[model samples]
Target chain A: MLKKPRNGNSAQHKYPHVGRTVSLASLSAHLGLSKASISRVLNGAPAARSIPQVTQDRILAAAQALNYRPNLLARSLRRGQSMTVGVLVPELSEGYATLVLAGLEETLSAAGYAMMLVTHHHQEAKLTDLHRIVMERAVDGIVAVDTSLPVIHSTPTVTISCPDPHDGVTNILLDHDRAAELALSHLYALGHRQIAIIKGQPFSSDTDIRWRSIQIAATRLGLSLHPKLVVQMKENLATDEPGFLAAQRLLATGIAFTAIFAFNDVSAIGAIRALQAARRQVPEHVSVVGFDDVTLAAYHRPALTTVRQPLRHMGALAAQSLLHSFTSGGNHEASHSVVVEPLFVLRNSTAQSPALSLQC
Target chain B: MLKKPRNGNSAQHKYPHVGRTVSLASLSAHLGLSKASISRVLNGAPAARSIPQVTQDRILAAAQALNYRPNLLARSLRRGQSMTVGVLVPELSEGYATLVLAGLEETLSAAGYAMMLVTHHHQEAKLTDLHRIVMERAVDGIVAVDTSLPVIHSTPTVTISCPDPHDGVTNILLDHDRAAELALSHLYALGHRQIAIIKGQPFSSDTDIRWRSIQIAATRLGLSLHPKLVVQMKENLATDEPGFLAAQRLLATGIAFTAIFAFNDVSAIGAIRALQAARRQVPEHVSVVGFDDVTLAAYHRPALTTVRQPLRHMGALAAQSLLHSFTSGGNHEASHSVVVEPLFVLRNSTAQSPALSLQC
Candidate 1:
């Protein structure tokens, strides 16, 4: 498909890969110096030979003018580091994971570290394979994005959004309990009593924590936390399919509820769809809230009210922690745990209880 | 956060990073064979060093039992290949880019190639920096996701959703013309004569192509193509903010259009919000159509009517093209451009024109 651009300006835009193929011999020839002298000067070798300082500066300027970038493999080999960080994600198709990865990449790149992306596809076998490959081969450090695995590498490791840890590992965790409190407290303040909750996938690392936190908070507020009002989704919470199915099930039970607290924005959207299908108007017949204010949360119809977990910020912090541990050569300085707070973003999704509206 | 597992089964699950560190000396001692013979056998040296077949099998079995993985850098150094691929993206936060990247990673990993992820952040300086670093590093092949650049290295390269290539580069285009036709034709078939299009960022690689296709198709169909009805969105089409602002401007223009053809799903969603805010009922007052039926498109309110691109498939094919070129040692075998077709998915967002409703 590649042909010379018909436009003249495009031809002048130098392609990314056409690097300057400058070698020691070329540098030596460009300047009146021997290959050995040019190499010694460029590499900053000790004064084994008395090369004039003026000649050295000239050689350096020529090399710079030629856009000379040192071979990374040779440099890494000499330095005993790959200058790369391995990033492990459970899946790449997820918006949440990808957004976090973008953050990690930004920080890692600025710090002169490349990222090796590895996805486990939520399969134990694939996770094992990725772990073996990443641990046995490259990457100076590792960052596991939203994964639950304990650190087992001799190299420094950091985790994002995951709560568990192992020896010599730093963890960046989201305050799940706080997120629940923010959502439930908001609903409670709005005079909601029979508030239904949509539970996340049962086996997820955060599901129990979030569920227990909500349960505890609801109890403290004297609100009913019953299994009949709790909807269970499938194993994959990222997709809306499980959310759709679970909401449909909740509606099928003929349960009466004035408000719904969905596990995430996707689930909230799904619940809204179900409510619409049943000819129930959102925030008029029932109110809905969600967690994880993803990019789509703000754009969705009714503009989902959700608890936002600074995904990008968490990613950046995790990358910084890994770099610090790897550079410091000890996990002690970087092993400290970081707990990031979640914020409640109010939108049009939730409103006053419909029973109160009817009484008024 | 690190603590002992509450369940006994958790203790049995072996950690992924704790690799069995079996050395050459241990293998030799266990099998009662010399280190030189074992090394030659394990390295698969030719018949010049004849080791017994039984001994070779025994050694291989032991290595497998011990779960030994060879050092990738040392092996690559010996073989003069890095066994890794560099993947470049404009940004990682967008669903489109990350979905394609997931496909690329899947194929590359299956073929024993680790992926080095580089994000240019849509900045010339970052692109230059990434180009310099990747070119100087150890990557056998390259894949640019949603980027347009000429091939600059002997290493094979494949681009996804990008047109206009240089020699020896294979482009995986999305058939933007077809996508536009699919969207425009669908709206036209629905009895909509006055159509407004939300144009993507003017400087994007596909913006012109998509715009031209829409213009040509609209003219061919004898449809009114008015500039007053058109909306110009911000450069970042993946985010909803630009779409929101652009749609607001179009609404402010007071253009009497029955339908809208947005640049992408994000833009379509933003348009929907604007239309709603203006007291316009979708499909009843105005119909909205979008492109690149992202995952959220299906979950969005009114279930966005849009064109779907096979993003993951494109990623896999691009990776395969690069691997084929690199492994075959000739760009000829892999320098074939592939254009994937887009599918039109009908949903609630679009319906018969309001003029038709009045007539009926």
Candidate 2:
């Protein structure tokens, strides 16, 4: 779905899960960093902590960068250790959330900290509804994904999938800006001059960064930043609307772009469907590229060339981060962030420029 | 995952997110009977209550049916109220879980019941680790799906998607037995006598019932059942014991069965992959059918024909049952068992038995 144009409260956006109980040791191991450092960072007790300043700085940075509020109840519970952590995700069944959850559970369980999971429906995003879980000291710590963050007084939390930064929570995110740069660089290196971008969702951190970076990269490569060729996508809207909206406008008022870069795999799928609907043969007529190499990308008729987010790694990392928060005596002084790089996967969706009649 | 061939409680299953709530209202709802009646049934306050015998019976039945157990701690705190309900599921985040949870959450939220979710991944069925989620007054009631049940003090609780009478919990389920009967009966009526049953995960409830029903139905129809005709599948087994094992076994023996009935769409997928690997045309050399009309079922190359388990309705009903238990005020009354019917979806996977084979 496209990112909503409006910004709700971070808490409202990142709903909390109320039915879990988390402990410091559980959260610490979930973090996947050194336990000693996790303890010193969370406790702020200022004992003879012996980690390097840089490492400690990264931990602290990670904790602060996440979009979640700290879980304070976890601090008290950890002092009286329970050896458990909590995980709350947007939709656990999604490939990304499931993978991360599996990673977190595996890491924490290995560290003797069990995981209590809370999966909320789309409606539970209300700030109060989401907050109720953590306020009751259900879990020692939390790991949140895609779903909104919680208003936590004491529980240490982490959020992933987006590049948003937080104060006390750790964030594991994708560098969309750099990813777009690579996409642009790859296309330019392939001798493509005039390119069009099918912007994914209107207001997503990822789409926003990619769009901005794509324009910047095009300008640096001496290519024109043509707005006529830019196609903006609306979230949850029918896939064809965006493709038709872009295609109709492009066809009526001819553009010189030779290649199109779409926001995500879904949008690219829409583009292909629309192109076929318009009797436009893919690659033979116009080369296209997409982001997020989802499962069905390879199954498409022409197959899709896309930017691959390290979803499996991200999934596992999210789990590891949460476990780390639970294990270190529930102390969260170490703030850190884990940003994974994206891969440019080559498939049949993209190709060399093709001849076309540009009436305009 | 294989269902462990074991009886109740002593198994090593781990259910997380349950068994830890100190709230009131949530407990009363799992009974699905009524709050006032639940209070009377649970508190043994019949002396002051003037309700009829039927109401009392219903209340008691609901409590007994759901295995309603009130949390003593919350009751003591709130003068007899535990606002939390514990929900344990085999694992959440799968496509089925997504729909089921949507139903469960929608109902639970409307009834004003706060829920604690426990999703676990057990290597196998022995649910001995259930002690972590049970053995406490944290929650007043419980609801489980595809997980092992705990033997203990009955608290209004329910279980779904399993074969056992689930001890004392309300066992709301889809009749896999009847579903299999319907599938096989339809195929037989279509003049398919030389049929093969492609079972999944060895001894799965759906598969086992299908396996037996095939034999029983074939007997009733006066069709001889062959030993090589009933094939069990273990497609991604860890043991290098013929990976994608079932399909290979079916093709290796070179025993020809005109019609094939797969246990589920997943195994059917494995079968299709197997058929492709073996260069056998589906519905030509072997007419195929599967169970569980999963989304991908309708999209397969030959478009698999399978049994549809009203997944959305089943999920909704399961959620509604759990919500009913939580809201009607923990009345330990009459137990209710709901059996939903399955439908046969006709597609290309099955056809009339070949005339050449029919004469033989």
- Most accurate candidate by TM-score: 1
Query: Each candidate's lDDT (Cα)?
Result: 0.78, 0.59
Worst 10 residues of 1 chain B by lDDT: B1-10
DockQ values of all predictions: 0.30, 0.06
Q: CAPRI band of model 2?
A: incorrect
Q: Give the alpha carbon lDDT tens digit for every residue of B1-360 in model 2.
A: 011223365433453322323222333565445565567656778552676777667666665665444532223334423444556655544345544554555555455444555455534432444434432324555666655454534456766665555444566677766777777777787777777777655423344555666677677777786788777665433111322457678778888777777767656666766776788777776677777675446534577788887766765576676557656754555655788787889988777677556577
Clash counts per candidate, in order, are 0, 118
A1-360 in candidate 1: lDDT tens per residue?
Answer: 112223465543676334234566567778877877877787788862477888778888998997665666656654557888888898886567887887898889989999888988666777777887887665688888767774365667888766556666888888877888899989999888888888877545567788889998898888887578898787564567677787788888887888899988888888888888888888888889988888778767788989998988999999888777766755465356788999999998899998877778
TM-score of candidate 2 chain B vs. the reference: 0.68
List candidate 1 stretches off by more than 4 Å.
A1-53, A61-69, A248-256, A275-281, A333-335, A355-360, B1-40, B43-49, B57-68, B227-231, B234-238, B248-255, B275-281, B333-335, B355-360
lDDT of 1 by residue, B276-298 (tens): 89999897889999888888787
